[model samples]
Target: MTTQPPPRASRPALAPRRAVGSRRALASRPALLALVVLLAAGLFGTAPASASGPASAASAPARAAASDVVAQAPGPLVWADEFNGPAGTLPDPARWNQEVNGSGGGNNELQYYTGSTDNAALDGSGNLVITARQGNPRGYQCWYGTCQYTSARMTTAQSFTQAYGRFEARIKLPRGRGMWPAFWMLGNNLGQVGWPASGEIDIMENVGHEPGRVHGSLHGPGYSGGSAVTGSYTLPNGQAFADGFHTFAVDWTPTSITWLVDGVAYQTRTPADTRGNPWVFDHPFFLILNLAVGGNWPGPPDGGTAFPQSMVVDYVRVHAPGSSGGATGAVTGLNGVCLDVAAAQNANGTPIQVYGCNGTAAQVWTVAADGTLRALGKCMDVANNSTADGAPIHLWDCNGYLSQQWRFTAGRDLVNVAADKCLDIPSANTAPGTRLQIWTCTGAAHQKWSPPAG
Candidate 1:
């Protein structure tokens, strides 16, 4: 699929990408311990990618076992589309860019991708239904066999791309021979640096031929194509992924990439885990989704395979750190109490104060992708939406108001974006009932906060 010639020396060599080769990697390396802890949305910096680095070997591959799985919650919601739109509607054009072609998807796939609602649309029940149907409804011909199927493929290329955090989606996969559904990512520099050099993360790939297992992989310079770093997790309960909706996610950071199925972390790949290839995941990357029919990995569809197979998407979201990387979770101070909403109430002016940490929803805080510190799906706001200093903190409904945006400073302060003030503990008071207030940032010890561990 390298359709373009290497770019001129002055330009990045970005172009089309296809599977590297036909060899499958079954190499073994140290397996990652289950990441049982949840990722906290702290404002932290991610590792930067090197524009030019020497390639490395593929001697060690990432690995994980079923017994090692652990459910790890990704931090606060960043960007999401619940597909909660009117039935038969196309996905949010603001978030998705659909592909329209039958060029075989570089894998000899037999599906003609169309922008028609018949192939991809929303179900009234809060889900994105991508269906693969039999016959050439569009009368698309192929280079080889008659085009026998049609499906939809889409990407977030025009919407968003972040360095790292948690990227996740809940999907009910399709099954039967030849059905290849994937949730993956491609580096944003794809138009500049091309594939392999830009990097790719396969969060989840399930071919109908293997209904019981899903794969997680990384593709780059030396690890592209047949030699990609790959690992998998099999459902322990003797169930197929197509049987129901399940979450597929990745806790991605500057140096490591951990894959999870339904919150259970199974594969963890780090720079050292690359076995020698240059690490290309340090840059921003966009997401892609498609139910490819008849690809190299799963072969072609057969009589036993069913048409009209679908991949139902519940949601797709991205969670990044606030700014200080304070790590996502309750922000605690003296007496080990956490910043909390009083009585689990949800109101426009519900007072927020320091409370003894009890692990209740009220005490749980998250630095969401939008920079809002949230508790119980509501945002930490300035009382009455005021921007004045001394305006007390409150729990309020999220309305995308500037008052809800917060910043975690390296100085351990939570600064409100609207007023440009710090979340202050009045008079250095260590009392649990002391309400949270906005004050001038003085780098005071009380102004510092701690987020939860990964």
Candidate 2:
């Protein structure tokens, strides 16, 4: 696991992550073909077709049946990289920023991360292959001196960031001693806030010695490094993750994050899991994928360790909040009162309140594909972007800020994405002009809403 330190003025780096700790025991290895079949049949199940890119290198029937399952598990597809391209070509530059450094990732990792295709490239078979090989031919200097191995680390830091969603990757891991591969994310404010204070989410991590198990963890102030909250998932029947491709994912919401492998959830961490520490994951975070060698957690490669180990990634996909876009109708709250623009005003900062469902222009709310709840050509916004419990709700010109984004949860709660709170009718007042506000999500009746009909 990468434990990179704060970014130095001269260079940006990851905080030192994961310490050597007790791991869950390994199960017996299952047959590779059986695992693949099980994943195709069970993991995908028989869900309706979801919007996704081209199918993988599977048969027509199998691909048609299972290709959309992963994307369907979340909401609508927002971002994706199928890794489809000619052999030896690099990943799409617009979607990834490959870090070129040998800072050791603050974990004493031995690999020199390079942008060269030699370390990371697309295979002709629709996969992004990150190869870790012995010897740094360019004589790259690491923190310890000459680098002994070469690998790749890439992130979407510059291109994309999301607050709550489902992030997933299908990967076939590398084996042998000292191999460290991870699918994780760091808060977008890392450069400004620094280290644990910026938050880290380890969706999936595996050390070479633990072939049957993978870990998921959270790190933030007061509970980071070895003290980070974490859990492990082991493949049933002695399966080695390297034997075949497996899907690793995390479903993240404002209040909790759940980890899953092959579509089977193994652990769910919530605010209470922090033990009074802050839940710093309320903001957006960017994705990271990397393979390292000889880190402190995995130790150095022995003579028996193999050279040229590679992590093969089939695709990476993300889905936004569950609410369907393009839905337009009245948003009814407590006592079935429609959420209205006060006095039917279209001016900015006009208060939003509960009123009778008269089907007037004032009550027409549109759930835009970009996550905004719009009416009168303005977005429903948190007044002044406040995070306080009684932050007022009003109309504002849509600027695509987080404060204007609203997510309709399955529980019928209208959540303000930025503040991680619920839209509420103040004091449960159902009066026609009762101004609305945002308060801590307590699943109260006043916090629930009947979102716009699709």
Question: lDDT: which candidate is best?
Answer: 2
The per-prediction CA RMSD against the true structure, in angstroms, equals 15.8, 17.2
lDDT tens digits, residues 138-205, model 1? 57876466688999988888888888888889999998998989899888887676666888898988
Which regions of candidate 1 fall more than 4 Å away from where they truly are? 1-75, 322-454
lDDT of 2: 0.77
CA displacement after TM-score superposition, residue 98 of candidate 2 (Å):
0.8
Q: What clash count goes with each model?
A: 16, 13
On the 0 to 100 scale, the lDDT of residue 406 in model 1 is 69
In model 1, state the lDDT of residue 358. Answer: 81
The lowest-lDDT stretch of 10 consecutive residues in candidate 2 is 63-72
- Candidate 2 Cα errors over 4 Å, as ranges: 1-73, 323-454
